[model samples]
Target: MLYNIIFIALFIFVIYVFYKKYSKKAKTIPPHWHSILLKEVAFYKNLEPSEQKRFQDRMMQFLAEVYIDSVDFEIEELDTILIASSAVIPVFSFKEWHYPTVTGIIVYPDHFNEDFEFSNKSESRRIAGVVGTGRLEGKMILSRKALRHGFSNKTDKGNTAIHEFVHLIDKMDDNIDGIPEILMQNMNAIPWLKLVHDKMEAINNDKSDIRAYGGTKQAEFFAVASEYFFERPKLMKRKHPELFKMMAECFRVKF
Candidate 1:
């Protein structure tokens, strides 16, 4: 009985210590609005003062909850990446799935190579890209160069971080076919599939601004669409209204 009481007391003490430490960290972190880093996030700069404040609050909450890797990378650059990513939140606002499945972001100096196995084949192939990969458990790998390109290439219709993050979102329900659970929930899968298929066909026929890579697969289509959706919302709205609407509903933000 004495040993049991001692064990209980130790557990309570440990919990108390952890809570105190967490509280201290929380207190030291300044409010999002005052974060000097926000000045560096390009997208944040484009927003109106009120919208910027809203985004700042959202970003601050995200930083508090998510494990961000700023080491070996400029803090301002990291802030820009996170802010750009957080913009997706408004796009997915109509859905209950706001937070990314990946909670941790690992930034790399540049594009990295990874060996991926092909189905029904014994050989593995090496692939290189800006953002290497992601998982549903809130883990994402980003290439700094790719991230910059995604933001820089307004006409290219490719964003590595957004592409990889979209994959993470699609994997939230443990499936990765370019269709996220939230987008599929209240909508018919056929239309979504058909729209993507048609878009891919149009791309192949040189009828769209989407890159050839976007026509590679349904997953690629989703990622490419995300690039266009964010970088050229007005163009996407004018060219593919339904697709734009679906993406808007998926992200819950107005373009």
Candidate 2:
């Protein structure tokens, strides 16, 4: 009788603790921009009404669950981040994963320089014009100017947020390669590599609108592809039909 009573008490205590944790988590709202205008900005005007509604709900839920840190920016500057986040929500709707590992966002005034230690060699390198950086476990650093430039330039085929977020996605498998697990699961690695190789060859032969940065590595290819996927979907579809199809399948969205 005594043991039964103690066991019941322990179970109740565990349940209480879990309930308290969940309730506390539920009470916290996501970080928001200072002005209402930032919240109102919409980047997906081209989406259908039904799709837009769905995306809005998902974005709200995502924001509520994920922590966002906005640094040293006026209320208006935050509008771009809000709009970009809202726009990308639709791309994630097909997957069950709602949140990324990234919890913090560090924003700079403009493009910044970063030093990197080479993995293969005992050498240090410096890179300039760094717009953004995304870590595997929920940390992102970005430049405000780069963010604006990414969204503002429609024809440039460069998107800093998308690029960083793609790195975050790539890190899901604890690998920084361009191939995310979702794409790898659905497509063969060999074919993906072959396609990328062919594309890089074409890009090198003549500068395609895909951008020169994409030729740096396979990981960069994924990031660059993500930019085009969202920015120039029609062009990507027209130019690389199969690759575009694969991206659509991985992201669980229709072009």
Candidate 3:
């Protein structure tokens, strides 16, 4: 009985600690920071005033939770704002959602190469951002240049930060297989699978507007599609309505 009491007390203490920690996170944005978002983040301008307020609130919370540290260069205010906004956009619809899988973000000076064993060649590529895995779990690395480019050119269907963050979201279910089980129902799984396959086929045939990189795999497809959905929503909706709808359902947000 004494041991049982101790165990229950410990559990309660842990829960209380977590509650206190998260409850203290900032939920409101300061006016200066709000202006920064207004001037710097293009996506913020796309939202309605009410949504713009929610976006700022969520961004403040994100910045409070996700530690942004510099890799080789000094982290700038715009970097933090843009990074926080990228993190907030995808999960904005789920008020209670936070990226538990991501512990922090590392900002690099520019495109850097990291050795990966994904292929037999063990080749290195100039990467803009990466979501951690295995021993590097709970972390993300992004390039300062790429982050600037993502927000600077709104018409381009690319946003490296969002792409990496989507990968993190895809991994929330303990898997990054492109099909986000957390947001997708089991009954709709097969349909989602079929849709991905069909779109990939069209991409391979050069008949699809989705970036060719998306056709590489299911995981890449999801990330690349998310980049396009958020950056070029109108083009995506007009060219690939079904895929756009699927993305809208998964994100619970309309671009």
Candidate 4:
């Protein structure tokens, strides 16, 4: 009887702790953030008012759950809103969703390289964003310049933040080799790889509109193609029908 009583008490204690931790994430978003989203993010701006509310809820939930830190620059409201907005855009189709694999976000003043150096004097600082690995697992690092640039160039169809987050989604399946089994369960790896290789050939030959970097490999192809898919769905659908169809199905969206 004492053992049963102890076990029940421990279970209740765990539940209480969990509730206390997550309940704080449910607070309503601030009023001004809506204006920021309306002004800056094209993805958010295009959403229906009702869907925009849902997007705001999810974006605020992301801000609450995931901590954002800056390495050098002061983190601004635009920085936080853009980062959280990037995180929300990819997973918005899911009603109740958050990045379990991402622990936090670190924003650098500029691009960093493989050595993770971001000094202004260094020429090696070329990478825009990266999903952490090894000791830095479950973390994301972004270049403030690249992060803002992603949104500023609305027609480019390249968002470093979204690119990295797609990598995180790919990472969630424990294999970041390209296929996100969690998101693309309906699509098998073989066909996906085949499609990736075909498109990569086109990119390498300058015969495709998909980004050149996607031609690097299967994983990059997934992320790059996803950037295009989300950024300009109409163009992608009109230009690359098959790939867009796959993307729409993978994201579980009609468009």
Alpha carbon RMSD to native, model 1: 7.2
Query: What is candidate 4's lDDT per residue for 1-255, written digit by digit as tens?
Result: 999999999999989866654565556888988888988898899889999999988888888777899996799989999999999888889877767788699999999888888997777888999999889887899999999998888788798999999998888888888889888887776777788889999999999988899999888999999999888889999998988988887888666
lDDT of 3 by residue, 114-183 (tens): 7532233445647889997778788898888899999988678999999999999899888899988888
Ten residues in a row with the worst lDDT in model 3?
116-125
Index of the highest-TM-score prediction:
4
Q: Tell me the deviation in Å of residue 24 in model 3.
A: 3.1
- Ranking the candidates on TM-score from highest down gives 4, 3, 2, 1
RMSD of candidates 1 onward, in order? 7.2, 7.2, 3.8, 3.3
What number of backbone clashes does candidate 3 have, counting pairs of residues 3 or more apart or in separate chains? 0
Any idea what lDDT model 2 has? 0.61
Residues 210-239 of candidate 2 have per-residue lDDT tens digits of: 777788889888878887777778889998
Runs of candidate 3 with Cα error greater than 4 angstroms are: 1-17, 116-125
Ranked by lDDT, the better of candidates 2 and 3 is 3
Angstrom error of the Cα, residue 94, model 4: value is 1.0
Top-down lDDT ranking = 4, 3, 1, 2
Cα TM-score per model: 0.69, 0.71, 0.87, 0.90
- The alpha-carbon lDDT assigned to residue 2 of candidate 4 equals 100
The best candidate in terms of lDDT? 4
